[model samples]
Target: MLRFLEVFAKGSQIHVPVGSPLIRKIPIFVDEHDVTAGAMKLIKVLRPAWDTSDVKTKLFTDGTTNKLVGCYVEDSPEDVVLVRVYGHKTELIVDRDNELKSFQVLHANGCAPRLYCTFLNGICYEFMQGDALGTQDVRDPSLRRLIAGEMARIHAIHAHNGCIPKPNLWIKMRRYFSLVATEFTDQASNVRIQQEVPSKAVLEQEMAWMKEHLSTLGSPVVLCHNDLLCKNIIHNEKDGHVRFIDYEYSSYNYQAFDIGNHFNEFAGMAELDYGLYPSREMQMDWLRVYLQAYKLFSQKGEEVSARELETLYVQVNKFALASHFFWGFWALIQAKYSTIDFDFLGYAVLRFNRYFETKPAAMALQIPQ
Candidate 1:
């Protein structure tokens, strides 16, 4: 084990033993709240040399599928370490490869954290030291403009042909709905409808709409950070620069998708329960900033007219509805098969209701060809 540990001296190997009592028993200093025993064990095996007496691990709160944990080795100055652990498997190996590639691309474009090293099973990057911009921070006009500018710059970078292929939106939507339907059928008795989950017939109609629209929508391929939630954006006070983290869902897609997705985050769709949805006026203001920045930074310099912007806005809502349905179904399934308690079906139904209520005006905004 010690011999194997030597190869990990730089903290770049992934196959190190994790969860073993022997691994846990290894004497190492760590911050109480920064990491789990499993994370620590992995860190110890691939120990990166630092002048600090001990290392601290701070688990970030923004993860769904994979555990996103940060390790900070405090020498005279603190340095950040980001570790993404996908469970042990061949799939994890592929994930690590993609993550490393994405990290490199983002770093080269000056959009993300500096890559330190990657283990075949996980990834580590130099920690980004800054305050994460919140809803309030994003509300500032200057800050919003800056963020918009950065996002445009990121999208301007050209991706290799099919390097990040776009997924067929309708196919993906059907898969999402199927997952939900399976869950609903299995737990029919437990499912409670808050706003009425869309009937299979209605869902099929929506899916058909997505398929038709997707085909008509021109492909404006660009490198996109598809998941640009506000939390993924970090602001460095020292340099007054904003950095993006998390590129797991990046791909080549329509520029409108990226534009609309970021706008959705600014719209505060995720925190609708908190009554944080932006006013129509506010939404327009954000759109203006985003479009201005996008035009300035995009290599194509394509001017997006107000009509086109509005149409894309409506399309984004459609995408959001699809996502809500998918998650709703996924949650329903998990609740059925696993020991988790949450009203996913109810939430999905609520989102569906909200979509219908807002869809008319949003659709009205679409540019008539």
Candidate 2:
């Protein structure tokens, strides 16, 4: 299940292969070396645990990103301790804000994983013990509302950054598109990824079309969980609430993009079955709960209308194209550089294909004046 090959450190820069050995080490030598070294460091310095000798750890292999995850089994299993090895950042395509800073903000707001300590190669945090909601759990009306409330709390978090007025849709995507082009150019030099993906011209055309249409949506900019696939939302049966994890892609963006991106996730995870996309009724039901919760948490009582919801409904579906294009082109970059073994090029094609198939109908939606 290891996604990376070799990770070598050279000076301040870490040339981590598709998978880093340090990450793989924790799982392989869970108790003897990996857990003992991590546990002793935590007890003497970070956070003292029940007993280091009794501690046990295991690798979590569900992630596509090559971060190594080791869960500690200790005195109280409910108090989960997770050690996460960092992935290489050779490609800083997006204008990423401080990942650690954003994470602390969410944790302080009581909505993210609780941090324990930060080490050179990895970090440790208290894992929220819960079931990672699947596509079916995501569709349930009550659980959907709970997840909506969590997103509202996240969007309301005020994290100041150098990008004065958060980057607009076009500005952000244009930069990422440029990076994708560079990746394509780089991958073309190698024979493995030479398969025909969407050309630069086609992406530009699609971008132009999206910019023209999305301009009319006029959604307010907010702090968003740029990535909200089902796995990120964990439902804790003990407390009957959902807690969100993974803030690496968190940013200030159109509310529509966040909501649309999440709704798009209803389509199967890992399997790439577009047939699982949600129905209009299901999405509208979700939006009503989302907007209501968002307003409630922000201490605003503005009445949301069925008509207003209708407009947002049209726009979120329209905005969903950005999610597909964003990750689709992103996969091209990963195809060239990622240590993960997944078919990055094939994934890109699926995303772009969804974009084209959905664009015409989405662009044609009628919003009442």
Candidate 3:
């Protein structure tokens, strides 16, 4: 049996050993509170040959979930390495081991960035060049097609061992529900949860209703970046391609759920306006491109038909409700455990409120006979 020891190595004295008890040493160091210092330390180990003194860092403040810092030398700005510090107690919400495996799989398939290494509470990886897509940018006709094509390629990635893909939606939602707290240590937080959030029993009823209704949607199971918010999508104007990042929520899931979740994100996060949610006409256009690209990538030779587009249109709209419901539970759990300063309880309320408000219309969508 091997044990982990936290022996901090100083200067250039570093050791990477295999199966030797006496020489076992912690490979990387981490400081969650002081991410800049931690990022520099990580860069030293990641690029041992580079002059550590010449390294420059930029902290990306747009991310609400994790601390992201880009470290690079001045001469080679494009070769930046991103250091990601996991949010407080995020382990309760994310499966780190699974996330690593998913990253490797997507990287191998050319769908994601190269993962450098994993430390105590974070990861180092290659930084891609691009601007994160804005709300209006996604609505642009040409960019929308590019986004759809990229998503189709991602969904077409082969499953491990050629085994059938299984949906992670219900399983993850159930897990998140289990983690949602009934009370908080802080009086204000506890009071807020009690007054704003639904009761555990009510949430359970909604979950059951979703499973009963959505299970039979006929949506295929595919690898998905379950959380495909606007910021998660990076567009490179030089190459005219878009790449999805943040694998913390990536998994095999219902296809419509992935697309529908992305549509929900059209409302934006900082200040949500569901009025911005894509119209039925807009979704039809997006789904057409996605279907054609999915067929081409998956090697399905059939021509995409109107019926096919209609089918997915109905399925995606219905699954949009699941997206709202899934994230509602996730926010509740974050409210209880996350150290991030965001109003997680308020986010949860918004999600659940949207879920309730849209349920009537979303469930009303039906496939043509």
Candidate 4:
């Protein structure tokens, strides 16, 4: 129980005992007016505690300005509600509305936590009293199938509604890539990054070429959880089902990119364990099962042909290039402004190296021109 008190554990952040009576007085540190209002409303729904009851707000600090408040009421001490105060880093502009809506949609489908309310800069949602999936959990054959099935289910969801704008992945990448000149720092790292990875001019050319070819790929474009890092998959130990959190990167994109990014995740979790990266055969095996699940979920699509499957296999391998490049630039931008202790520049180099590493494999495939 004490071990779960920390935000991230060694391999995984396991479930914590939330409802137990071994209560302690944690500080009710809150500043944002919207957060307070959101928390009070959640409290009201939990019980009639405004009249007379002890209320406590527990804080979860992760070194970022974003405020995470756990609202606990006297009547329902066990039922904890988390208030996510959206403190947007000026450098990173995520659509708060899109993120909230994505969360709600996934929650409705039982793919994410139950969202409660949205305010000025944040939203309150159900906190999963569970553990994060470990590196092995993601690599195991059976578990990988289960996760693939879950991703298939997510992709089946319609991204844009009547007025909601669909995500423009090309524009998004262009926007991220635009920051390279201004964001990348550390002359030594810049020199190393330049020598090891594609130069900005080369990347722009590659991106243009990739975009032209990928748009014509046979696979259907569906809602993609673009970032499938291992840390984001939450496993409910009680039932063996996993729910994905962090909707900031979820958007409408090519199915291949989503699957490729996930396969890319198999390369490593916290650190680069390229040795753990899946073999081509293993990736294809998972893709087949994923397609089966996708077939079941997508009612309108015709049965996948062997040729379609082969195309997808090749396309996924190629899209792997885009995934690495996407994150490589992302790491460079994050390295510029992020306050976290992790070495963003070094991580940027790693992602860039992965981009180069995957390029040859993509070249070998007879993908769409």
Q: For every model shown, what is its TM-score relative to the native structure? A: 0.72, 0.82, 0.90, 0.76
Where does model 3 exceed 4 Å of error? 1-26, 184-189
Q: How many Å off is the CA of 271 in candidate 4?
A: 1.3
The predicted structure with the larger TM-score, 1 or 3, is 3
lDDT of 2 by residue, 1-369 (tens): 132221111111111122212211122222222544654555434445456666666667666554545444465667666766554442354332345555666776777776666565555777877888888889898899898888888776655432233534566678778876754565457454445566667788888887887876777677787889988889998889998877667666778899999988888557877677888988888888888877777788847888889988887888899999988866777776776668877887888888889978887887867
57 Cα displacement, candidate 1 (Å): 2.2
Ranking by TM-score: 3, 2, 4, 1
Task: Extract clashing residue pairs from model 4.
Answer: 19-78
lDDT (Cα, tens digit) per residue for candidate 4, span 51-111: 3247677766532325577877676666777877655352363545456556766766678
Order of models, best lDDT first:
3, 2, 4, 1
lDDT of all the models against the reference?
Answer: 0.57, 0.69, 0.82, 0.67
lDDT of 2: 0.69
After aligning candidate 4 to the native by TM-score, how far in Å is the CA of 302 from where it should be? 9.7
Instruction: List residue ranges in candidate 2 displaced over 4 A.
Output: 1-44, 48-51, 90-97, 161-165, 168-171, 183-187, 190-194
Tell me which of candidates 2 and 4 scores higher on TM-score: 2
Q: What TM-score does prediction 2 earn?
A: 0.82
lDDT of 1 at 237: 75
Clashes of 3: 0
